[model samples]
Target: MTLTEEFDQSLLPGELILLESAKLFGATNISPNAKQWEYTRKFPIDELRQAIQRGFGSIELPQIFGGPGFSFGTKMRIAEELSKFDLAFTFALIQHHNALVRVAELSPSDHSRELIASMLTGDLIGCTAMSEPEAGSDFSSLKTVAKKVAGGWILNGKKGWITNATDANVCLTYAQTDTSLGSKGIACFVVLGDKEGFIRQAGYELHGAHAAGVGGYGLVDYFVPDALVLYAPGLAFKTALQGVNRARIHVTAMNAGMLESSLSIATQYGENRRAFGKSILEFQGLAWSLANVATSLEAMRSLAYRGARQIMRGEDALDSAAIAKKFGNEQTLSGVAACMQAMGANGLRAEYPLARHLAAAKLLSYTDGTVEMMNERISGAVKKRYVL
Candidate 1:
């Protein structure tokens, strides 16, 4: 049986249908072109537009906003399915969808509403910018400053390591309005990329996952009207934290999906390739290695599902999300390597995705939040929960 069949019984019929469609979309559009995209570092804009046309761009957007309004659990499953084929494209798609959701639900301006209409059609792509050259996890230390003007705010700073930064036309930017208040001084604004002062920086040449369009940009005297403010200083930082739990869970699901793909490829090759007058599967050592990978994949799925359930129930998922991300970070890196080893020399070939998955796995270790950050978060709760 396929890996998804093991858990299909637990999913709702509608969710299953969505998953099937996502799988088909990946096979038709992503898997075939992933190698080429990586080699040339090309952004998959056409495929991204197709995905938006098919409703992947607004999975969790409210029905009132003309979106399918799928549950958060379903969204997580879709993310997993798409990621199995290509994590770079899947990550970019998720970021765009999130930007759409933020504008649709949070922005009160008519200009934002018009942008949402364009985003839904893929005419305009969107992204969030939070990281800077001097600040990553340290949100309170961001140097980007937003000075209040007569009509709105004048933003001046640079953002780095942002997903979809190379091609996005609408940016949800975060900047500090006051230095003394630290994190509380942070605010979020809708900055149009085509405007005068917003400058798109050169894209990064990543070791892998190039389709993600990961890059940075600079805002020099960029002006955002008061109507475009999504979150004021007092609430912007908290809003960002609230989204972290879901983001962590999404990354965990992606790791699980990649592990599943790697295990399947390695297992098939081991069963078919003969060595020493017999299939490699006959060797106890190789069989046990794949078995361990399978076990880890199952555990990863369980943690991802648990975290997703917590978010669906509107419970505080900080601990669960941290645990899930930490476990995935440790297992996926080693697990994919083990799968690559099982195939011997063939694993390193460009035809096989194992090498790519390996690099992406390392990259993901630093995505969302670093493994060290996860440990720091979990350590804070250890005494409260474990001592009992």
Candidate 2:
């Protein structure tokens, strides 16, 4: 069966609506030349803006805030469907959605109402800046400091590997207000890109997802007045960790979509290309490999949707999210590699998407949180709950 047939049978009406919207957006704007755009590192700003205007990216925001107010399961399906067409482009939209969600959580504040309005109208772009060069996985080691001043706080330090940093209109940033307290001293703030002392620097030469603007920046004594502070000291990291549970769910959905796409490509190629007096797929080795890929995809989807259901019910999902993210992302890489191997030289070609899918998998594996961190979290949770 085809991807659509499988999806149509499984998804609800609301979920199908978002999937159709994503397919239309991808067909019109992204799928045609996604490879060339990835190669040239050119972000499709106008197309993406149109997508946001069409309500494709902000579905998770509450209806009170001009969003569709969909369930978390619907959000995951949206990410998965969009990613099947283009991982980098889907990622850009996912990042924007995440920022909108963060703004919603931090609303009723001075700047949030206006900012969220602008985001829904596509007048602004949003991103998160938390990772620094020296503080990849260890939030405790972040050196960016927000020194309390007479009027407000003076921010200083640099952040690296920030998605959408070069193009975002606003950033949700975290910094230490009291290094003596380590992670406990961390605070969050809303920093406008056009503001003075907020520098947008160039990102590394990337292998994939160039359109996502994975870059870095420095805050040179940037003064953020009290009005712009989102989370006070001792609360920034808490908010960040709270956000991760949902982010991991979307990340898993993205990986599953890419894996399904890769499998489809391999399946189509294997049926048509013949060797040894028969189709390659007729061989048990290749046939079983594809079967295993399908099985793995189903397993990942089960884990991801279980976590999404928990989140929808307002229950704790950290453990489920970690398991889904770690297993989903890791399996996506392996599955996509198998698909590429099935296609042989064609998979390596830039014209095909397998190679780019591999790059996207690697990119996601490191971001959000690493597999090692997930293992630690699960082990800790298990020990705390199961100890007699």
Candidate 3:
């Protein structure tokens, strides 16, 4: 049996089904063209439609919202399984889910509810635009402003490094509503892509996750009616922070998937390729390297699942999520790199996915939160609780 098959057999029924769905979707639609799509930096809309048709887009939301009502942990496992085959495609879907979850949680307006209904049906694509060029790690200093108008607000600013920027039908955007209040001044809004002054610029030439359509846009006097305002200044920053802290666990799952795939590829290559009159797997140094990576991958999985479980139990997981995010990113980068080195030059070739995995590992480090941000979260807690 294949390695994936062996792994699936060990899972529970629901998890087995999720893994099977991801495997089927990847084998039939995504895995074959991942390289071509990456080279062209073009997302596969047709494949995405297929994914939606299969109901993968609405995994964790409630059935009332057209979702399958899966638990957070189940959804995270599905994310891990899907990303193992195609990280870019999986990343795009994750971005869609992010917008849906955040909007569902923070938006209390009638219009936001209608948009959520549309998103659940897969008729609308949603994305979050939270990071700006100048306000990445320090979001309190974001230059994007939302000024009150006669009947609504005029948003004037630019957001960079947004996933699904060019093609999403709606955006969950944040802006400074009261600059004098610093972090408390920030507020979230629901901005429709077709509205006047909402302009989508060209996508970025990213080293990895090309199919994710990560790009920037300029909102030149974009008009947002009061009905579209999700959270006001006093509550917006807290909502966004909590949403991101939860989302970090999903990011950890994606990285774990990548590390799993990288290890599988490296193991197969080492066992088959011969050097010094024997398979590379027979060498003590190479075998020990693989052992170390495998250990790290398991540890990452444990941490990610623990964080998910904590969230499912209605507990605060800020510190757990931060630890998982930081360790997962660092370890995945190191483990994937080690796997590539174990395979020698063949791993660096386009024919193999090690090069792609390496690029993605680097990209994952910055998304959601930077390694520095994660460090701050964890260290702040440590100092508060343990310092004399």
**Which candidate has the highest lDDT of all?**
1
Q: TM-scores across all candidates? A: 0.97, 0.94, 0.93
Clashing pairs in 3: none
Which numbered prediction scores highest in TM-score against the true structure? 1
Q: Which digits, one per residue and each the tens of the lDDT, describe model 2 over residues 212-285?
A: 87888899989988877888888888878988888898889889999999999999999998999999999999
Model 1: number of backbone collisions? 0
Stretches of candidate 2 exceeding 4 Å from the true structure: 1-15, 106-111, 385-388
- Go through the candidates in order and give each one's C-alpha lDDT: 0.90, 0.84, 0.83
Segments in model 1 whose C-alpha atoms lie over 4 Å from true places: 1-13, 386-388
Ranking by TM-score: 1, 2, 3
Span of 10 residues, lowest total lDDT, candidate 2: 2-11
lDDT of 3: 0.83
lDDT of 3 by residue, 1-388 (tens): 6333443454567656765787788767877888888888887766776776676776777776667666777667777877777777888887887678666764466776788887766678888888998878887788999999998899999999898886887898899988789999998888888888998988888787888888878899999988788788878889888878777898898899889999999999999999999999999999999999999888888788778878888999999999999999999999999999999988988777778878888888998899999999999999989995
Q: How far is candidate 1 from the true structure (C-alpha RMSD, Å)?
A: 1.6
